[model samples]
Target: MARAKTTYVCQACGAVTPRWQGRCESCGEWNTIVEEIVDSGVGAGPKSAVAGGRPVALVPLAGETETAARVTSGIKELDRVTGGGFVMGSALLVGGDPGIGKSTLLLQAAAALAEGGRRVVYVSGEEAVAQVRLRAQRLGLGDRDVLLASETNVEIILATLQNGPAPDLVIIDSIQTLWTDRVDSAPGTVTQVRTSAQALTRFAKKSGAAVVLVGHVTKDGQIAGPRVVEHMVDAVLYFEGDASHTFRILRGVKNRYGATDEIGVFEMSTLGLREVDNPSALFLDQRDRDAAGSAVFAGMEGTRPVLCEIQALVAPSPLGTPRRAVVGWETSRLSMVLAVLETRCGVRIGANDIYLNVAGGLKINEPAADLAVAAALISSLTGSPLPADAVYFGEISLAGGVRPVVHAPLRLREAGKLGFKSAVTGRLASSDQGGDLAITEYSELAALIGQIAAGGKKQAAE
Candidate 1:
């Protein structure tokens, strides 16, 4: 008989170590290493009673194949974020902070799918059946012909799924709460999470059911578990929103069959999460047009163009090291923009407390918002209010030159659709016209700075 094997694994980063240590060298998380027995019964192991597999034929990359049909859940925003709809036999991992409405969104989608005559199974590991039913009733989806289960044992769940009619969609409330008899470690451990995910992914592929696994997020807003879980799934999405705000954003970071970096906006209400058909207007609603530090940014998320306000405040600081408080944007990007303004534009802006925010709680990731951020900062520094109808987008180089961004025509088209009359962007190709709006092209950041300062002077004079 082969001797049992034991190993130490880091719960935070899934790094395997021979011995336990104070902190994980990979993720720098403390006291996360745990010991577990390997080569267990359920999974594979060395010198075990399991048999070897046979080789299969390989196919060429270029081959004639039919595209798989997608199962629509009837929730437009959910379907949009999942690349038109959930593809059959694809596994997805969705992560979010607690109370951020991850369950509500998935529940809504499952109900929609069930109502559309698709067999849907919702297995809740975190909540009981009564709690889920209460929430479904609260969301007014109680009448939907959806099946629910409150279980966490992976074996039992798989057996249950296999015994019933093959479901079109299977939503697991959370992957962290799942445990398997194959892994001797506790639930939510690195081994268990990985094994459970692999089993479910295999199930999805074999049974042609779209598996949606919900995951909890850590304090740093990353999916709490081994990173391998993310790799096991075909797609990874994040549900993000602020508690104070009534809106939520479902963003896709990885997709094998669809575009990445896509977003779907939803508004939370007593009824449930409602899709925002026009996210540009939803993000820019109730704007303070006369605010000196506010500028609208025309940016893109995947294939969609989004317009949001960038607000800035620069005030004299009493402390030697002024505070740089930023929300909904990156601090390093802010620092880079500040350095460019001071070094290239000869602006003395570092000796103040700077605060920046993207209005309506929207987070921007693209570098195209550099021009908008700089404009907001300059506007606040000079007390100039950018035109409410004007939109800004472009990249700023360290040499203070404005670089053109992709999809300029699309951005301008979105601005025009929202009743914006003017656009300030980088040099546009001649073929790409302003399309019903006054367009201003800038090759250098200094030119826009001069224009904004001149506007401030002109406003002060008036």
Candidate 2:
């Protein structure tokens, strides 16, 4: 028997140190270092020569003879986000906050595939088979002949998939909860999470099974456990939404099969998770009629055109610091917009507590929302709101000039579909041909503010 050496690893950055430290020097996070034993007794020989496993050299996939076929994951919204569907033998990691529907989404997808006449197996590490059955019944999935198992051991999972009947799709309730006997650490630790993920990645490739791994997120929103877990997977999808809100978004952070920026929206209901086809309409629901401090923004998330509301409130701050708060939009980004208003537009809101929010619990990070933010601030400051059926999409510079945004035509077309009367954008001449909707363009923020204060009133009357 040989003794194993131990090394202290930073849980935050995965930097290994000889000894424990109070803080991780690489990531600057405090008290995140943990000691792990490095076992050196195992032989560094190829196990691929064994009867069960075979190895192949890596080569360019373009040289391979594999034909690209679109395999639906069974969830329509998820398929849209993933660029039609999951590729054959592709592995996906779905991560989200607790109670954010990560498990439910994958389970629903598995049921859908089973119903589509494809064999699907769901291995639950956290819940029992009965619990999974109960949830499946609620989702109206009884007609499908899906296999379910409640186990966390990686060997059992692999053996079941290998020797038993072939399944088209395989789903693990969570990757963090699964553990391998080879690793001496507990489940969800760096060693256990990384090792099991690597094994599953290999299994998915060899068995030609589309694997979906449910992942847990840390407090700061990164996938929990080892960083290597994300690297090992093929695609990383993040399920993001406020638990208080019914709408949840499945965004592809990384995708080997398709575009990474796609997003799928869903609404949680009593029957399970239901996909929202017309997300723009759902986002604009219950919008106030010609209300102050409100403006619509035509923003593009990935290739999808979304009409989101930008709500701003400019009120006197009771606090001495004049607080600045924003929901669904970055606070730092909002601060820059406020400074642009003060310097370029000459609409000072320094003493007032400015607050901005994106309606329908959807967060907007695109620069196209800049014009809408500016217009909302001005509408609140001057007490002259834009028309209820108006929307803005353009980026504002520090010097108050309007910058052109990407996909202006798509934004305008979607706005037209939503019955927006006006499309305020940087490309004024280009939008003149758009029938039925007024195209207003302003080079300077001050001029735009002036137009929005007066012209908005006229548009409302029309």
Candidate 3:
């Protein structure tokens, strides 16, 4: 018998090296290189053997194709993030921090789908059948028709799945625990993960079933395993929430069939994950109109419009270097906003320690939040409260100009629906400014700063 070829693979990046090294040259990660037997099927083979394969029929790109059918989980929030529903023969990878309701959410979704008369199979590699049953009972899903299994061997799981009628949906509690006999590496290793994922993906495509694979996240919040696993999947969803908060966000970072930046909101409770139909109202549940540093921001998430509060605190610094603390927003973006305020608006806030936060643990990534954040910082520094019924949304350029953002009509419509009577935004086109809410357009950031400072002076005199 021929000796198996051994190679060193970097667990961080899946880069293979002939010899072992302390540090991975590809990803600069240390101690992540592990020795593994390279399967001949995975790597290059002999040229003589490859040349004997049958040729595949190639189709033109203009050929007609049918839209993939969708299997709705019956959870509105879950379905929304997945672009209406899970597509047939698609593989979705969901990742989250430990105990962040990943399993709970999937269980609830599985139960809902099962109750709707769809065949659903949940295979848990991390928990036993009894433990899963207990969880189902706790979540009030013990009576559902969802099939449960506790297995980790990829071959056995595939065989069992093939034995029954092809399930409408199959959920693996986590992909990390799955191992295959075809690979000579331990479970969760780079090689095993890649091999197992490829097998499951192939099964999904060939069997016409939606496969949902749970993934573990690294300490830095990235999906644990080789990045190639993410590439192999059809869609990637992230379940994010702070342990201290009950709200969980299901964000779609990649989707081949739908929008990539869509988000679905859920509130965790004793009953399981409850979908929030109006996420804007849930996010701004604890609004304090009298707070000086608080400003309401009308933002867009994918095609949906959301209103959130941006809070800022500016205080005298005791240290030579003032502190800058930010939560739910980027720190570097805050620095750029501060620089624009000082250089163009003459807001002497550099001497003060600044802290900014997006309420309800919701992270804002759009530049349209610039105007709201700037408004909050100025309000806090000048000790003035902004208009309670007004919403802010506009991007601030380095040259101190407030730029118009897309979805202006949607943002204003959502704000108006939530009882906001006025909005402060960039100059809007004539066609986009016909809403019931009074709109104030500002072209320069300095003008808005001057108005806020004047409000502060007026309040001080009173």
Candidate 4:
């Protein structure tokens, strides 16, 4: 009898090593290395079981292709995040933190699809069938005709799917709890996750049924599995929201059939997730127009324009190192903005404890928010309240120059729709300045800083 070979694998990045180590050389994560048996016989070619396989036909690139069919769930927000609807024969991986409403959202989608007269199967590996029913009843979806099952064995699940009439959509509650008999490792191990995902992906492709796999996320907000699983799926959607907030954002990080970086906003309520048709209004509902250190930012997410508030506080620091606390925005980007203000604009912000936050728990990633953040920071430093009806957006370069960004018209239109009268932004082309709002163009950051400081002094004298 031959002995089985073993190798150490990093659970974070799937880097395999021959010997055990304290930290992973690939991802620099500590204590993520685990020993697993290596199956040498896996993927080996069959010797005499059958004759040689036939060759596959190849087609030209210019051939006519039909549009992929999609199944529309009645939930418009869910369908929007899924590129209008769930594509047939596609595998989507939805990941989020625990209790972040991954299961709830999927259940709602499944119920909607079933109500539309489509066959839907929801197999749960993490919870019992009774628990799922209880949740459905709580959400008022108990009357839906969605089929439910509770099992984690991959082989049995595949067999059950094969033995019944082909369903239009299949949902796996979670991939971590699933285990395959072929792999000797535990359920959540890297090998098992990869193998199970591959099997489900193959099944979806062959049966022409859309499959959704729920994945658990790590403490750092990444999906808890091998990175290969993400690559194997046709789409990847992340459910994001702060626990303290009622708003939730479903963002598509990767999509083959739709636009990437697209988001669908939902408001969590006692009934279920309610789609927010106008997320801008929801984000700006509690704005304090009279407060200093607060600026409304007109930004773009995918093709949609959004307006949100940026709040900044510049207080005298009591410690040797001033604290820089930020939420819902990148910390390094904040540092870069501060550096530009200090170096080029001659702002003495280093002595203050700077705290920045994006109201409504929405994360803003566009560089266009640079001008808004800078405006808020300067307003806090000078105790000057920005114009109550003005919005801010523009990218600030390292040289303290305000650069123009894309979709200026869209941003201005959204601001104007929200009753904002004026916008402070980079110099715009004549064609992009046809909006109803007043535009104040600045080529450099120093000019805006000077204007705000002068306004503050004038207000104090009065």
Off by over 4 Å in 2: 40-66, 428-435, 453-462
Residue 71, candidate 4: C-alpha displacement in angstroms? 0.8
Model 3 per-residue lDDT tens digits across residues 265-302? 99989989898999999888978999999999999888
| Candidate 1: tens digits of C-alpha lDDT, residues 103-185 | 99999999988888999999999889999999999999999998999999999999999996899999998999999998898
Give candidate 1's error at residue 37 in angstroms: 1.6
Candidate 2 CA-lDDT value: 0.82
Candidate 4: the clashing residue pairs are none
Whole-model Cα lDDT per candidate? 0.93, 0.82, 0.93, 0.92
For residue 300, model 2's alpha carbon misses the true position, in angstroms, by 1.0
Candidate 4 lDDT, 1-462, residue by residue in tens: 878668888888788888999999998999999888766322223446656878899988997899999999978878888888999999999999898889999999999999989999999998999999999999999999999999999999999898889999999989999988877787798888888999999999999999999999998999997899999999999999999998899989999999888889998899788899999999999788888899999988877898999999999999999999999899999999999999999999998999999999898888999999999999999999999899999999999999999999999999999899999999999889887898999999999999999999999999
TM-score of structure candidate 3 = 0.97
Give the clashing pairs for model 3. none
For all predicted structures, in order, the TM-scores are 0.97, 0.91, 0.97, 0.97
Error of 1 at 79 (Å): 0.8
In model 2, the Cα lDDT at residue 227 comes to 74
Clash count per candidate: 0, 0, 0, 0
**Cα-based RMSD of candidate 3:** 1.5
